[model samples]
Target: MGKKFLKSDEEVVDPKATLEVSCKPKCVRQLKEYQACTKRIEGDESGHKHCTGQYFDYWHCIDKCTEVQMQSAACSIHCICGFSFALYSLYCMFLLIWSMERSDEEVVDPKATMEVYCKPKCVRQLKDYQACTRRIEGDESGSKHCTGQYFDYWQCIDKCVAPKLFEKLK
Candidate 1:
């Protein structure tokens, strides 16, 4: 999909540069500390000394800033019933809204429901398949099978159920 599914179709972005630019102002002190630590570690050929602490402090600052921005941008929409989903996860919020103004009914399994409803309509095909099975039972030669009749029965039920199932789901 090579960037086709991205929210933007513009030129490729340098994420590190973007993060640095956005985080530099609020995290300048930590950034300077990290830079200084790097300079100090430059002569350590054994590679035991590191700047992990200062790097994490800088990232913590960026995370705090990003969290505030995400919160501000995320729940800007005020619900008509005067409730806000600022505290809830996005998935729970979606489920709450999607079920609103709809029936308070039990959940259903569409395939099983369609199968029960379609069984009566496909009785003829089922009977035919059963007879084919009986015929195959008498044959010592394993040349005959009830596959055709079984498929016919399945096709009959599917023809009746597929369109209705799609409609109900929609």
Candidate 2:
């Protein structure tokens, strides 16, 4: 008999089917292996002499081809460093000038240098004490220094050489 194709309502089907298939297993393993190997390859090889030589040679070629690019730019690293240093120097100079301009007399310290400077009004006020004493003595002796205009500072007769200037005005 010859093989005959049939159209039927019910077709041959497996009720309890057990099939095993491995598709592209070698490809999956190769992808994982390649990923693992290439992951650290760049970092590990970057420090190597051969890789650094190649890198430096590549940069050197690029630098030679673009000579102007390799030259100092307006915002180059060296220019920035030099500009910052100059700015710092100028700031320090300005600070020194400002400090020098400020007066040093206001600083508070007990151990600092002490010097005597004359003030005229304080000296005149101190001399008034002697004048008051002379006036008091001459008034008793009826001398010309006693014009009787002074009433002996409220008539208590206190000595001017002593500490008490006069009784408090009430």
Candidate 3:
């Protein structure tokens, strides 16, 4: 009369497997933008070659969107517990200061700058540098190796971009 236990090898199917998962429109849009940027980076062999600034811009966009999604999820939980207003106020203040700081520094569009200033010969080296950084970025080895990777990536970018800029300027 005891209930029979399924064997460990037996597959247990979820009843909700047919249900559709929906994301907020903003979240969907952000996901699309991130995907598009990733595709562009992957596709444009020459255009993004010497453009570390563009790479940084894309990375920042994805990071900001991810943060927004995380904050929105946290806000919902906080709202249920009556702390959402305080969190929202702090978030808004942080955004304002961040926006001001971002505006203080003029961001040069790297693609345009490279088109104007960099030589074609540097493209191969730039591509290699970008590939190196991309690999390091995906490394799961925590902060132990990240500091060295960061240094190497920046050094590679500098070597690839700086000389071309100086040579073109002169």
Pairs clashing within candidate 2: none
Error of 3 at 52 (Å): 19
Index of the highest-lDDT prediction: 1
RMSD of 3: 15.2
Q: Between which residue pairs do clashes occur in model 3?
A: none
- Tell me the whole-model lDDT of each prediction, alpha carbons only: 0.67, 0.36, 0.49
What local lDDT does model 3 show for residue 93?
57
- What residue runs in model 3 are displaced by over 4 Å at the alpha carbon? 1-64, 84-121, 124-156, 160-170
Candidate 3, position 36, lDDT: 64
Clashes by residue pair, model 1: none
Model 2 residue 109 CA deviation (Å) reads: 75
The C-alpha stretches of model 1 lying farther than 4 A from their native spots are: 1-107
lDDT of 2 by residue, 1-170 (tens): 55567679767643212110111231343345445545534343223212333345334333332332223221253444456687655665555455445422233222111101222323444455457645554233323332232333312222332223222222
lDDT of 3 by residue, 96-134 (tens): 556445532434445446644444545555566566666
